[model samples]
Structures are given as structure tokens and as C-alpha cells.
Target: MLKFFRSIRQRLFKQKKFKNYILYAIGEILLVMIGILLALQVNNWNEHRKSKGTLKSTLKTISSDLKRDTIRAGYLIEIIELNQENSKAVIDRKVTIENFTTYPRTRSLVTIYQPFDIQTKGYDILKRISEQQENEKDSLFADLTQFYSLFIPNIQKSNERLEKVVIGNLEEFQEFPWFVDWSQGNTTEEMIAYFAISEDYRKKVAAYNVLAYGNHLQLIKGYKENAKHVLERIEKRLEED
Candidate 1:
């Protein structure tokens, strides 16, 4: 094409048709400009397609991560509820202190400090994508950031506080005979009598268990809701594609 245009320009110039040659020159310049513009438009389209593909992939990963979180949260919530019920039974005398060592239900009350495992790798990838594409300030991105950075961390902190309280109370009460074996200290009857005598310690255990139970419930609710919202948004975005 360049050779064809060059041959025309040479012919026009050799024929001393300066007026036609100038007009042809301007026409050639316009054609070249049009070709450059078309190339640029195609490049922009390619880039946009690539970016959209990346976003879709990122959203898929985030959805999977959120799904895992919801499942784990559900399991933890069940455990928390069971722990609460067992502790309450012990406190209310439904499950007597005499059964604390031998009974399975009563045994769970003493085992505290279970922590929730939150997955953050997906969120971290999203965060990095947001940083790299600073111009793309979408609402979904903002919600994702808040969920991972603020809401999730807040739930984790609450769990940490609950664990601390449980640990502190357990440390104070570990020397009690009920926590130890019959061979090491008092007999089962003697341990039951000790627990029966210490109403305050029993109440503390019950209170901490209840606190943890409530916190876990609230965290699970928030997490599930957030996960649902994020998944819906991702699906919607993918649909738009």
C-alpha cells in the first residue's frame, strides 16, 4: 500500500502537476491518520477485553472464598451453640457437677477457646487488583474492601477477646479437682462438692460461654449476609458480560 501511494506521488510530481500533487499529499496524510486511529481503537478494545477477563476471574475466586467462609462459619456457629447449651445446662443444674468428668455433654463445657478460621487470600488478591487499577472505583470493590478489612477483622477481634476471657477464667480454675484426675487430687465426689461450693466460678464459666456463643452467632450472620451479597454482585457482573 505504501509503494502504491509512493508511485502515485512520483508520477504526479514528475508531471509537474504541483496543485494535484499537493492535494494528493494531503489525501495520503489523511489516510495514514485514519489507519493510525483504527489501530488505536482496536488496541483500546483489546485492553478493555483483557481487563474484563481479569475482573471476572477475580470475582470467581472471591465467590469461592466467600462460599468456604460461609460453610466454616456455619459449622463454628453450631459448635458455639452446642457449647452454650452445655454450659447453660451445667450452670442451671440440668447437668449436675457430678457428671462433669464422665458425661460427654458436660465434658464439652470445660473445653473452651475455639477460634474461627477466616480465609483472606481471595480478598488480598482483590485488594491488589484495586490498587493496580486505581481508576476503577466501583461500589462492589468498596463493599468488598469493607467486608474484608473492617467487618471480618471486627469479628476476629471479638473472637480473640472471647478466647482471652475463657483462657483467663480457665487458668484461675484449672487447679480445681474437677479439671484434674481422681488419682492426682480429690475423688469425683470431692470434685463435684468443690464445684458445688464455688458458685461464682461456675457462673463465670457460664457467662463466658454465653458471651462467646452470642458473638459467634452475630459474626456468622454478618459473614453469611456479606458473602451472599458479594456472590450476587459477582454473578450479576458476569451476567452483564
Candidate 2:
């Protein structure tokens, strides 16, 4: 193509058609510029499409993560609420052996600890992207940042406070002479009697309520609601996209 244009330019120059040659040269340059602009536009369109696809996929993954978190949060909330009630009963001296069958939650409430379960795999990837692009101001990005960084961490912190109490007490429980039947999962008579009238047992159960269970239960409940709200926000953002 260059050769063909060169031949035409030579013919025009030899014939002394300066005016026509200048016009043709200008037209050729314009065509090249237009072609380059069109190619750049297409490349940009492809990049935009690829970016949108990645964003959609990541949001979906985060949505799934939120669902898993909410489900686990629901279960934990139930146990914690039971713990709250059981703790109260023990502190009030209402957990007698005869009534022990009715309030069997003391054993588990003191011995078992559930960690805060949250998934941040998708959020972590998206967060890095947001930071690299300086897109923290974007509403969706900000929402995600708050959910993962602030909300989730608070839940973890609260649960950890309670978990330390539950787990720390669990190891110490074995040292109790009355807890010999712990391995068998049987609520021994001595254990029931300790819970029934022991001031130390009441204090321990009160400490459980004050340290973590009482507040942690509410946090888990609120977290489940926030998780759902964030899930809704993600869906809305995806729809807008």
C-alpha cells in the first residue's frame, strides 16, 4: 500500500500537480489517524467488558460468602441465646439436679466455644483492587469495606472475648474433682450439686454472662441482619451494572 501511494505521488509530482498531491497527502494522513482512533476505541471496549465480567463474578462470590456467614451466625445465635438463659439460671441458683434435666445447657455453655465464622476471600480480592484503583469513594466499594473491615472484625472481637472465657474455663473444668464423668458427657450428681449451690459456680456463670455471652449473643444477631443487608446491597449493585 505504501508503494502504491509512493508511485501515485511520484506521477503527480512529475506532472507538476502540486495542488492535487497536497490534497491527497492530507486525505491519506486523515485516513490513518481515523483507523488508529477506531482501533483504540475497540480495545477500550474490550477492556471495559472484561472488567465488568470480573466485577460480576467477584460480587457473586461475596454474595455466597455472606450467605454462609449468615447461616452459621444464625446457628451460633441460638446457642448463645441458650447460653445467656442457662447462665442466668445458674446465677440465680435455679439449676438444681432435679431441675437439671430441664436446664441441661450449663455444661455446654461453660465448656463449648464457637468461633466467629466469616469468609473474606472474595472481599479481600476486591478490596485490593479498590485500593489499587483508589476507588474507596465508590459507594459499593465503601459498603464492602465497612462490612469486611469494620462490621466483621467487631463480631470477631466480641466472640473472641467470650471464647476465651468458655475455652479457658473448659480446660480448668477437668481439674474439678466432681467433673470426672465429663468424658462420658454425663451430668454427674456432684456436678449438679456444684451448680446448685456453689457460690464459685454462680460467680463463674455470672462472669460468663458479663464477659461475652450476654453481649456476644446480641452482636451475632445484629451481624446476621447486617450480613443480609450487605447481601442485598451487592445484588443491587450487580443489577445496576
Steric clash pairs (candidate 2) = none
Local error of candidate 1 at residue 8 (angstroms): 3.0
Per-candidate alpha-carbon RMSD to the true structure: 3.5, 2.3
How does residue 153 of candidate 2 score in lDDT?
A: 77
Off by over 4 Å in 1: 99-103, 107-110, 134-137, 173-197
**What is candidate 1's CA lDDT for residue 232?**
89
lDDT of 1 by residue, 1-241 (tens): 7899999999999999999999999998998899999999999999889888887788888888888988887887787777777667667766555555544444335446667667887777887778878634688878888778766777778878877786776676677656666325445675565454357657775677666766666777778877888888988987897
What TM-score, over all chains together, does every model reach? Answer: 0.80, 0.87
What tens-digit string does per-residue lDDT give for candidate 2 at 145-193? 7767876777778767877787788778779886668657776678778
> What is the C-alpha local distance difference test score of each model?
0.73, 0.79
Instruction: Judge candidate 1 against the unseen true structure and give its global Cα lDDT, from 0 to 1.
Output: 0.73
For model 1 the TM-score comes to 0.80
